[model samples]
Target: MERTGTTRRRALIGAGAAVTAALSGCSSDEPGARRDAPPSVSAETLLRRRSAALSSALLGRYDAVLAAHPGLAPRLAPLRAQVALHVEALSPTGDRPRPASSPSSSSSSAGAAASPSPSSSASPSAAVPADAGAAVRELASAERSTAAAHTAALTGAPPEYARLLASVAAAGAVHVYLLTKGSR
Candidate 1:
């Protein structure tokens, strides 16, 4: 039997949507599930999930900064790539949805909107203090602070994540130097 092109496409789309819905439902902790249903996952799984979410959030912020300051692109390209690699490596672990009460959740949308698109070539303005340096230092500092959270994420996260955190930390330190020097 020959199916019409529209019918075939609609069938495929319906099947895909059903599969996505099923996966999304299964991924969440069910309300009726026992508090101790074999814990559903090991400590490593929890750690990996949390770490992946944190890493994704941090990288998202950095991507925004790089977007805003075009001049930093040449210098930050490698670090951004590393963050991307880290995000991909940890992506199998899904993001943990932020609770309404979480302080970070409140600012999340604002941060996302504030991130620059990289096409705009905005420089550090004279409005800021002399010691503040260029936008890169500020960006590096943000990465460093987030790296510390990644370190905290390591407490219960997989052992491998510790190494990733270390790499990010080191990269952030290098970013600080490069940004400062570039600003001079």
Candidate 2:
């Protein structure tokens, strides 16, 4: 049967519409339909987050040390500042709580509050050392361990994160050296 131009045009249009709908349905089922969406967090990002947490813990250690041995403040203050900087750099938002501004009040309060009692159980590391030398040595050891962790994490990090981790590791190394060899 012969078809009129109008009829042929209508049929062609309808067929095109059906094909377009089928293709659209197929594309909607694909995982890449939202290609513009932000990607989910990667393992590397999680690792960096853990690294940041480690940095935070190190800062906490510094605070504990200072609280325990205010006499070491003259020597350890600079190292503590460096560790704070590292925590800031490693954290994605740089929003970590800082040590209280009033060092004497904060340190004394932290010292008293954190002091171990016979009934209170806490991690040995959380306890402030009895002497300034011991505090320095403890911080030096912690710094070394943190730096080693950063170094190990670097192997699996992306290039940008690796650079950041390396810089943090270097800063930790410097703190370790100053803690061990610099006059306290």
Candidate 3:
């Protein structure tokens, strides 16, 4: 088992190391450039803005579904409120919410608080299906897409923001399962 012949994994790892070393040294020609370090301030702000926008869009989708089919409000409102919290959390100036309560308690409280109001007046950017089950399926589809977008955004996000996005994305996936299961 001690043979010294080159293996595919070893060769690939060696090539990867060589590539990493080459890339790590590719700093800007400017005098103050830091090798292997990306600029964080502006990038972080942009990431926050983009994440907030995604949450807001998803929030709007929730609103659209509610406006089209008000009967679904009891089930959808809690999820919509969660998306609103995501918008706030992702804002550049917004402070993250404290996780003081257990997830079940917090969700139940949001559900109680968001009980179907006749005046939830957010305009729907996209048409919602008239059928209630179809509308639930549409929301599930939106949740899946939004979760993917949030997960994709984690590539270069700061660790704190990345953690938040990951949690939100996980919630979105759960929302998908709940919506689909309930619709059936």
Candidate 4:
């Protein structure tokens, strides 16, 4: 009669086969990916670029408020400087920002912010409320919006980038408090 129970030879053979299959799965699938298209950017690059752009737009908004109401300078100077630093920090290594006519679209950034040239100066936007109190509120709204965006981005950012976002978001919160204080 044939033995029905599994022999050592059979068990060893099955284990060897299983390990081979598992290892095959572990090896990289080298040939299946398409490589013909332009290389895509890494997630870090995209995140940094977006953060820098946000800061740049905020800087332009500050410029607009200052242009529209120069009297607010003493109140806004330090905050604007902080924002300019944020822009610098968020920008990729070696990239210098230039004063831009259109911060959202313009690709340049600065080491020391370039004086906004005549053509590039943020005009006294009609959107700026004439009342300084109202204008401060408007600026506060912008700070709140940008801070929220930075906070939202934290989940996806790498460790270092997330830290930067967190700090900037915190600073924005403080700016909101400063601007709204006493004006309330």
TM-score of each: 0.49, 0.62, 0.62, 0.66
* Candidate 4 local lDDT, 76-169, one digit each (tens): 8778878877877777664545554555542223312532222333445536787888888988998999999999999999999999999999
Task: Assess each prediction's global lDDT (C-alpha) against the native.
Answer: 0.56, 0.71, 0.75, 0.76
Model 3 spans > 4 angstroms off:
1-41, 94-125, 182-184
Task: Give per-candidate clash totals.
Answer: 1, 0, 0, 5
Best by TM-score: 4
Tens-place lDDT per residue, model 1, 21-122, is: 998788646776565556466667666666556556656655556656655566666666565555555544443332234446423333332222212122
Residue ranges of candidate 1 with Cα displaced over 4 Å? 1-39, 93-134, 181-184
Point out the higher-scoring one by lDDT: 1 or 2: 2
CA displacement after TM-score superposition, residue 153 of candidate 4 (Å): 0.4
Please write out the lDDT profile of model 2 over residues 65-166, one tens digit for every residue. 776767777677666666666655666543344444565665334332322221222246488678878767887898999999999999898899899999
- Model 1: how far residue 67 lies from native, Å: 2.6
Poorest 10 consecutive residues by lDDT, candidate 4: 111-120
lDDT of prediction 4: 0.76
- Ranked by lDDT, the better of candidates 3 and 4 is 4
How well does candidate 1 match the true structure in TM-score terms?
0.49
Local lDDT at 50 for model 1: 61
